[model samples]
Target: MRHTWRWFGPVDKVSVREAAQAGAQGIVSSLHHVPTGTAWTTEEVEKRQQEVRAGGLEWELVESIPVSESIKTMSGDWKAHIAAWQQSLRVLAKAGISTVCYNFMPVLDWTRTDLRWETPIGARAMRFDLIDFVAFDLHMLQRPNARAEFSAAVIEQADARFRAMSDEKKAALSRNIGAGLPGSSDGYSIGELTEALGRYAAIDAGRLRKNLIHFLSEVVPVAEELGMRLCAHGDDPPWPLLGLPRILSTEADYLEVLRGVDSMANGVTFCTGSLGVRPDNDLPAMLRRLAPKIHFFHLRNVRREEERMPCSFFEAEHLEGNTDMVAVIAAIVAEEKRRKAEGRSDHQIFMRPDHGQEILEDITRGAQPGYPAIGRLKGLAELRGIERTLSHASYGLA
Candidate 1:
């Protein structure tokens, strides 16, 4: 595993120098100033790369050059958006950034009801409470047929939760879920969001997936030609939410995507925390099975509340979540070994410690919601220790 960190450009609270100091081998970043669907110029890509190199690190992966919503729904100048997306890929490749991470989650990128859910250790972490989300969907957003989506028990609980909250708390919940996070596409206002969800009213998981495959069919060839790997990030929580269909949430989803495009350039950005939300995901086993198509990794463990669909979850210490950290690391290390045996140059997958808990100095530093400086440094340290141990053990007797 190649140690990597996601840096949100020069304006980020966590500087590139700090990232290098934290022992990151490379930087995962993006040109956030550019609007979605606009083609990134080669000059812009190189300028960012220069910044990364100046801090003594290479820009190995573009965390994302976002996919346009038009492309997702196949509406509103989608062909033009697809052409621009392809051009962006060409530009990125020319700038020597090989791996690109993106997602197809409609409307919001990732939803968290609480940005600072208090941890038992007095640290703060991002969390998604199922009841809170249901409250927003049924009582707050008031989506059509929202009551039908959840069981009566869940709806009743959500109603109580919704009725108990003050107006301020309700608005906070709305913003937390609808407002964009760092490196995501954009936020939606309540009115704007309702309209957006309305567009997807007829689009189910199957149709949305078909749209994704159609996208891959067009872009994967360009990626292949440019020697770039396009990594589709899995949906956070790995389930549908707010009536929007979620397709990229399971191993089966990935298999469909991989086989649909049938190109080496078509790959997945194996995000353990996102997929780990589902008890059925089997992280280590999935890692072993889909190792070849894993172009990048967002390595973080999530502690699932009830071990079922729509369960609450929060970011845990890198080694302390429900995921078997040691086993997952072993599978990754083993995959690298197999790739090396086959003489593949890109055997070492780029992985970054994702969504670290806010603790220590990070609590007051007010870093990006989940990308706290000290918190992620601590995570990287723990993950590095694990990687070193696993790598050493693979060598047989020392």
Candidate 2:
């Protein structure tokens, strides 16, 4: 595994030098300033590559090249958007940036009900509360079908949660849910967000899955030709929110997409925190089964409030969460070993110690929600230690 750190850009609070010093060999980032549906030009790609090299780090993966809403719903200039995405891949491949990550989550990228949920030790971590989310969906956003999506018990809890919140709390809740795309500073107002959700009202889970398969059918061929690995990130909470169906949340979901595309280039990002949120996921098992096609990995843990879907969760310490971190890492190392034996050039799968607890100076550094410096450096150190110990022990030489 190649140790990678996510850097937003030159404007990022955590500079490339800081990431390199933190022991990251590669950078996971994207052209955040670029708008959705636009092809990333050769000049732009090379410019960012130069910046990474200057900071003594290789740009291993573009965490995303945003997939447009038009592409998701197959509406309003989606063909042009698809063409632009293909062209962007061509340009990126020409620039020698072959590994990329993107997600198919509708409206908001990853919803966190609280950005600074206080931990026992006084540190903060991102938390997703089910009741808060339901409150936002049913009472705040006032979606027409919100009641149908949940049980009366769940609805009652949400109603009670909504009723207890102050006006200030309600506004903060709105802003948090409307917290738009990852990496982008832009967000939406309640009105704008409600309208965005409305666009998907006619599109159900089956249609959404078809849209994803169709998308892969169009783009995976381009990725294969370009020698690129196009990885789809799993849904953050791994459940439907605001009536939007999450098609990429489970192992079955991935198998369907990979088989639909039928190419090595169509791959998975293998995010533990996201997939592990669901108790049924079985992280180590999923990694072992899907290892060959997992091009990138987001190694983090989440403390689940329960074993059910739509349960509340908070980002936990790398080794302290419900996820068996040691086993997950072992599976990854095993896959790397297999790939190396097979003479694969891309044997080293890039992984980042994702979503560390906001501890130490990170508390006031105002770093990106989950991308704090000191905390991630700490995580990388812990993960590196595990890899070293495991690697040494696995060699049965006398």
Candidate 3:
């Protein structure tokens, strides 16, 4: 794929121009200031595209459209919200921005409990350690099913872990998970988290999937008309646990959603990091099977630990993760070649080093993920070497 860096627009510590200078040809971004369920106008889309283009970079992917709560809950004004979403897609299409990336992770977008995860290189990376997450959910937030979310054995494990953690450690984990993404719908206090889980207590996995399909069925045709394509990311570990509903958890789940809408406009964002957390994902094979369906890619790595409950534990480290980065990149290259052979006009897929550490120079100051110069430069360097070497040497011994 084409090299794209994640840009959070002008307000981002890392600007679009900076990304251009970072050897990036494209910028994967969103109108983060736009609240969920709001209609983004053609003017708004054009302005953002112009800004990116002015920075000497192409606006390659809209990282998300931010699915609304009503749309997710299938409640009041949902149809109107879906229509607004369709309108936003048309607006982008009119502006000639064809690629859009979105995720269906409920409430929070890619939740993590620790922003200062450790790496062997003496650099601290952001991670979603399961024990840290569980401690926050059960003890800090005190969500009703939080305790039950952890398996019985794991609950005991978590109790010991929580007891062992100092007041400072628990405080950090709570802040980390709740600091919230820049433009998240609502910031959760511990109280809100409890209430939110209870609200979702009624919407099971099946209902959530149905809502997703219904939302897709409604707007995918609009995507087709605009010649716009969406890269819908799957919900990690889709099982209904602790009353949290999951729509796109498995390969079958993905297939069901895809088959429901059945549109070229409807596609998936294949984040190797998210899927790689599960050993069963089989990254290389997933590429072969889902090649035709993936519209964008998030290439990163994660190590899986099966012992953790709710989510089998995973840690993000570009090279060390369970997802075979080498094979995954090779499959990506092959897919691009296949697309080219099939006469596809879509440009190379957009990718970013999903999340990076608050490292060396950055640790003393800054948010956890947004602008990590050292870690991401290292990650991009590694991936660049991987891509170039693989392009030269078929599949092995490169």
Which candidate tops lDDT?
A: 2
lDDT of 2 by residue, 1-398 (tens): 89999998887888899999999999988999998898899889889999899899989889898999999999999999999999999998888789889999988898899998899999889999999999998888888867888889888999999999999999988988899776797688888988998899899888998999999899998998888999999998899888888998999999988888888899999999999899988999989999999999999999999777779999999999989999998888888888998999989888999989889899999888888898899999999988877777555210
Best-to-worst TM-score order: 1, 2, 3
Off by over 4 Å in 3: 164-167, 179-185, 237-242, 307-315, 365-371, 393-398
In terms of lDDT, model 3 sits at 0.73
Compared with the true structure, all predictions reach lDDT values of: 0.88, 0.90, 0.73
TM-score per prediction, in order, is 0.97, 0.97, 0.91
C-alpha RMSD of each candidate structure in angstroms: 1.5, 1.5, 2.6
lDDT of 1 by residue, 62-141 (tens): 87878878899999989999999999998888778888999999887888999999998899999999999999988778
User: On residues 10-111, what C-alpha lDDT tens digit does candidate 3 reach at each position?
Assistant: 766666776666677788878888877889987778888888888888787787788877888888888888988988887888777888888776666566
Each prediction's total of clashing residue pairs, residues at least 3 apart in sequence or on different chains, is 0, 0, 1
Clashing pairs in 2: none
- Badly placed stretches (over 4 Å) of model 2 are 393-398
* Candidate 3 or 2, higher TM-score: 2
Whole-model lDDT, candidate 2? 0.90
Rank the candidate models, highest lDDT first: 2, 1, 3
